[model samples]
Every structure is written in C-alpha cells, then in structure tokens.
Target: MDHAVVIGASMSGLLAAAALHRLFGRVTVLDRDTLPTVDAHRRGVAQSRHAHGLLAKGREVIDELLPGLSAELVAQGAIRGDLQRDARHIHGGHRLARGDSGLSGLLASRPLLEGQIRRRVSALPGVRVLADRIATGLLAQDGRVTGVRPADGEPIPADLVVDAGGRGSRTPFWLGELGYEPPREERVVIDVRYGTREFRRRPGDLDGDLVVIIAPTPEHPRGGVALALEDERWIVTMAGYGEGPGLALTEFADYAATLPVLDLHHLIRNAEPVGEPRSYRNPAGVRRCYERLSRFPEGLLVIGDAVCAFNPLYGQGMTVAALEAKVLLEAELRPQAFFRRIAKIVDAPWDITVGGDLKMPGVEGDPTPRMRMVNAYLERFHAAAAHDPELVLRFLRVTNLYDPPPSLMSPAALLKVLRGGAPRAVPVPA
Candidate 1:
C-alpha cells in the first residue's frame, strides 16, 4: 500500500501504525487530542488516570513490534514483575498462592505506557503521528475507502484506512453512511464504575509486593488493584458493579476497606494521595461482530476497541489490540479475512471478560450450560489455587492469555485441582 491512514493516536492506533509501516510506503496516525510530550494524561483519555495492567502476552507483542520497548518503559519507571511471584491475587473469595510463574507483566499509568509507545512508533521509518485533527468521516469511492475527511481540513487521501479508535469509534456509522450494513453487535451491561488515586510509594508498601489484585465475587461485588508504577508511585483503582467506589478520598478509602481482601485497603490507608481522586463508569462490554458482516469495504479495516471493548477488570484490551496488530502485520489486507482473523483473537478475552461479569447477580446475561459448567469448575479451581501453587500458575497463565481455557481441564491440571484444597463456604447472593 502506498499510504495507510489510521484514526486515533492511542495505544491501538500507534501499534497499527507501526505494523502498517512495515508494509506501506507511508503510515499516518491522526488523533483529536494534542497528545502530550511527556508522561502526562490527555483530555482525550480520562481512563488514563485509572489503573492499567499490561498483561504478559501484550507486553511481549508490543516489545516485538517496537524492539526494546519494555526496557524503555522500565527505565522510565514502569514496574516489571513476574506475574505470579511479585503480585498478590485474590479471586473466588480466596487468596491465590503465589509462586514464580515466569510470566512477566508490565505496570505503568495509561499515559506513560501510551506515551512511550507513541514515541517509539513515531520514530519508525514510515510512520507519522498527526495530532489535534478530528476524523469526521471516511472518504470512499467504488465501495472502497479512499481517505479520511477531518473536521476542519482538506481530506487526507490514503490507499488504505484502519479504524483504531477506542470505544467511541464511529466506524459503524461511517459504514452505514457508505451504504454498507453495520456490523451486528453483542453487549452485556456490566454497570462497572471505578475510583482511582495515585499515592507515594515507600520501600515496604504491601510488604514489598509490586502488585495486588483483589477480584470481586458473588458475595462481595467490589474489587481493587494497586500497581507500583514509574516515578516511585503506586496507582490504586477500586471498582464495583452497581454502586461502585465514590470519587471522594474518604469514600475511596472506605470502599477499599469493603473488598474481600484487606491488602488493597492496607496499602492506601496510610499512603498519601498524590492528586485529586478520579472516577470512570463503563456501563457495558461491547463487541461489534464485524467478521459476520457478509460484505465490507475494500481498503478498510477496524482494530482495537473499535472492534471489541472488554471489561477493564480483566486487563485484556491492550493485549487484544496488540495481538490484532500482529495479525495485521502478517495477514493480507482483505477486510473479510482480516476481520475473521481478529475475531478469533477477540474470542478468548471476550469470553473471559463476559464470563467474569455474568458471575455476579446484578450483571444481565443468560449463561449457557457450558458457561455454568465452566464457572462451576472455575470456582473449584480458584479454591484449589489457594493451597496449590501449581494451580495458581495454571490459572494465571490462562488469565494472562498465555494458555487456552481448555488447558485448565487437561488431565494434569484436573489432577492438581482434584487433589488440592477443599472448597470453602463461599457466600452466594440470594
């Protein structure tokens, strides 16, 4: 392709630009926000103030696309830790046993992570990052996208166009305007809300642990995560399903104390807050079934949250976007084939995200029999993981996208679960 224009300059857009740079003569990425020159938040991404966990697979793929990127993040103050060893995880109302799982995870505020990747991608041979430009619509001829029409400027022409805009993307509406059928969509209302604050990190916080994740359960619908980010600070995010954590500092700390585990609360109780607390509300998880669209425009494709926006709790969004960029690097630029490929990439994480949400009584979804069976097995698995470090490794591997869900049902894994700890009396919401 002579030129490929990608809309949005966020993490997904930058990755798409990097991938297209390898195949196209010139790759341009456009975003409405005048992106920051430093590790600072932009008005475009309010969620950047919240916690962001770069799963292991995501870190690996991003580093591959922009070599030595992980080291760059860590050197800039991002924390790198073994997923199981340096972190504490509480799920299914039980604290999972910690061990060296060898899966490496990266933790940095969303702004820093996105800023570093944007810096590296902008340095690519054929990549360009254009800021403060709003993509109003796509320009098309002969049922193929030909360029992008910005809000206030002349149309920027391109041989190919990719939509990497996050949840707010307007690609479907653009498709409808072009006389193409909009992709079918699947949505599960989660009503997730978040409260986050940054705190000064000391030497012995959480007894030297780098990360702590306390997952919500049926009985207690609240969850929390604290990560040691760059700049010697800790970013803590507390969340819940319906009535989530409040934005007030007192409310945030009080909500943390309600979690099933006290590690998150303990870390924040004495730590001094660095800034005003921030909050975000995600009402639902959405997936546009682009792969099922019988017809799509040539010279156009969609990636990232434009295609699927999962529940943030699973920390799957960035990893899924990075995987799609990798697929784009290798696949031919056929829209149908491309969507089909990315659909498979979205399946695992989508399932994991929705599955976790559906476990709560307040989330609206009809669980399939298989879902029920899997959830039941997972409850047992989580209980076993508390006493068996091997089960913890297996579960972490799956959650980190390193292993398939079915791997947990393997004979060896089943043996470990069967012979491990007995299930405790887990409370169920009546």
Candidate 2:
C-alpha cells in the first residue's frame, strides 16, 4: 500500500492514522483547525470542555496504541477510580448501587485526552499531520477512492482514504457524486442542549468519591457533572431536552440544587468557576448505513462520528471509535481478506450507537421492532442496575463498550432480574 489519508485529526482520525501507519508505508492526517501544542480546547472539538470519561475498553485501546498513556494521564492529575465504588451514579432519580467490579476508568477533559494521543501519535514514524487543511472532496477513479482534495490545494493522492471527518462530514455528498447511492440513514432527534462550566475544587473538596447525577426528561431536560482532568478541577454540565431553554450559571446552580443526589450540587455551590459556562446544542442522532451500501468503494472506509454520531451525553463516541480502529487493524492485517472483513467488523459498534439513539422519543429514524425491543430491554436493565450491584457492573462494562450489548441479556443478568432481594447474582468481572 502506498499511503492512507485520514480526514480530520480528531480522536477518531488520530486512531485511524495509528492503525493505518501499522499497515501502510505512510499516513497523513488532515484537519481544518490547527491543534494546540498544549491541552487546550479547539473550535473543531466543541465538546472538549464537557465531561469526558475514558471507559475501560477505550483505555485499553489507547494503551495498546501508546503504551503507558493511561499512567501518563494519571501522573498528569487524571483520576483513576473504580467506576462503581468511586463514582456516584444516579439514574432517573435513583442512586445506582455500587458494584465491586474492578472496572476502573480515567476521568479527564476531552482536550487533555486528545492532546495526549496527538503528541504520542505524532511522534510515530510514517505519520504526518496536516493542520489548517479542509477536505473538499474525494479523489475517486473507477468508483474507488484515490485520495482527497483540500479546499485550496491540488489533490493529495493515496492508496486508501479513511473518512473520520465527524458528524459534519461531506463523504455522503462525494459518494453520491461518484454515482454510488448514499447509504441508508437513521436519525434520532432529542433536541438536547448542554451548558458546561469548569470549577476549581477547594481544599478538602473532592476527598469523597466523585459523583455523576443523571437527570432525564423529554421536555424539562437532563444533566450531569463530575470531577475531571486536572486535580481539584470539576467539569459540570447541564442538559435540557425539547424546547427547554439553555442553562445559565444561575439556572445551572438551581438545577444542580434539585438533584436527588445532593453532593454534586453542594460541591458546585461552594466551588469557584474556572471559566465561563459554554453551551452546545445537538438536534439529532445520525447513523449512516455505510455497510448497507450495495457497492462501497474499495480502499475507502468511514470511522467514528463520520460513520455514526451519537448523543455525546452517552459518552460512547470515544469507546466506539476505539473499537472501530481495532476492527480496522484486524481486517487490514489479516492475510486472506481485507475490505470484506472490514465491513463486518464495523457493524458491532455501529449497531450499539444507532440502537441506543433510536430509544429517545421524537428521534427521527426507522425504528424497526428489533430496535424497539433492544431499547425496551435496556430500559429494564437501567432500572434494575439501580439496586443490583452485579447488574451495575455488567451495565458499566457494556456501556463502557468493553463487552458487547448481548452481554446485557446474559444468563447472569437475567437471573438478577428474575431473583429479587438485593439483586446480586454474579460476581463482578475484573
């Protein structure tokens, strides 16, 4: 293979570049924004300031890509805590039971995590970063992608093209222009809006376990907060649904005051804000059915938000992206088949994200009966997770994208739902 060109140098793009570098001679990552040298937010990644947690699976993938990356993050003040024991989780006004699962995770800002990955990936041989470059269209010949064209320059040629351009990608348009029908799309509109504020933790604060309070709603909205990134820094976010108004600082404080779990609110009230409140509005969930396309071009692939963008509130994007990169590597390195195997590998994470998004009311998409069933089961699972510690761990593992969604319906989980009384049936997985 000559070289693989990856569009967008965000988390997904960086991971794709790493995978491609291992398979091909060279990899080039093109991004419209100039990434910062330090751990600072950028315009392209609007969700950077919001609460971001690296689930167990995502952490594992990052470690594989860059060994000791997790330890480095921890050394830089990222908190590594047991998901159940050290994290307070409230769902639908109920406190989720803490499980003894050795399932732990890194709590850091999106910028911090992305910056770490960028620094490591940039140091790798056979990889180059092209900042301040926008991908204008695909370079295709005989219906297969040849490379990418930037907005103000000549086309850059490559043997493979990976679209990690994110939710706003123009891949569909380019594909359609090439006479390849665009893939089927599923969309879910939650009308979710978010406002995030960072705070400097006071002395004696953050000594207790960190907390995540999930307030759900169709009209009034849902929100959450947690200690993230640097020590003594908290990233608090408030989200509203439907026609609900954006959250102001005063409004955020008022909403935090009403959480069923009062610790988050109390912490916020006493703490000082590190920056002004930033808000983001997401109108819908999008899943492009690339695998369903009758004739997907060879030497081309789509990953991350470019393939399937979900509600960030779920925190599934990074984990799903990491898993996709694993799939890409497996397919590329295998001897017998490549593109054929690639399609199947991307299916798991795609279904997980799209299926969950279809659950939200007012979401736009063809929600087949199977999708509805999956949503129903997850609702029961969430409700059961509140009281059952074993169930909570399983739920965490699944949500963290470590185990497949089918793990939720395993015999262990089923027995917990069947047998009442404290709801502990299986030992938590390490």
Using lDDT as the measure, the top candidate is 1
Best by TM-score: 1
lDDT of 1 by residue, 295-354 (tens): 899989999999999999888899999999999888888999999999988998899888
Ten contiguous residues minimizing lDDT sum, candidate 2? 421-430
Model 2 per-residue lDDT tens digits across residues 1-430: 8798999998999988877888888999999998898989999998887777677888988788778999988888787888888777765455779867797788888887898899888988989988999999888888678889899889999898888899998888987888888877867776777778888866566566764657453222455767655767788886655533235656778777655566667777777888777888888777777766667677678888887787777777887788777776766533124434544545565576566555545556666777666655555666677788888888777777667777887887866654542433333322
For model 2, the superposed segments whose C-alpha errors exceed 4 Å read 203-207, 215-221, 243-247, 258-260, 333-384, 421-430
Quality of model 1 by C-alpha lDDT: 0.89
Clashing pairs in 1: 77-230
Model 1, runs deviating above 4 Å: 421-430
lDDT of each: 0.89, 0.74
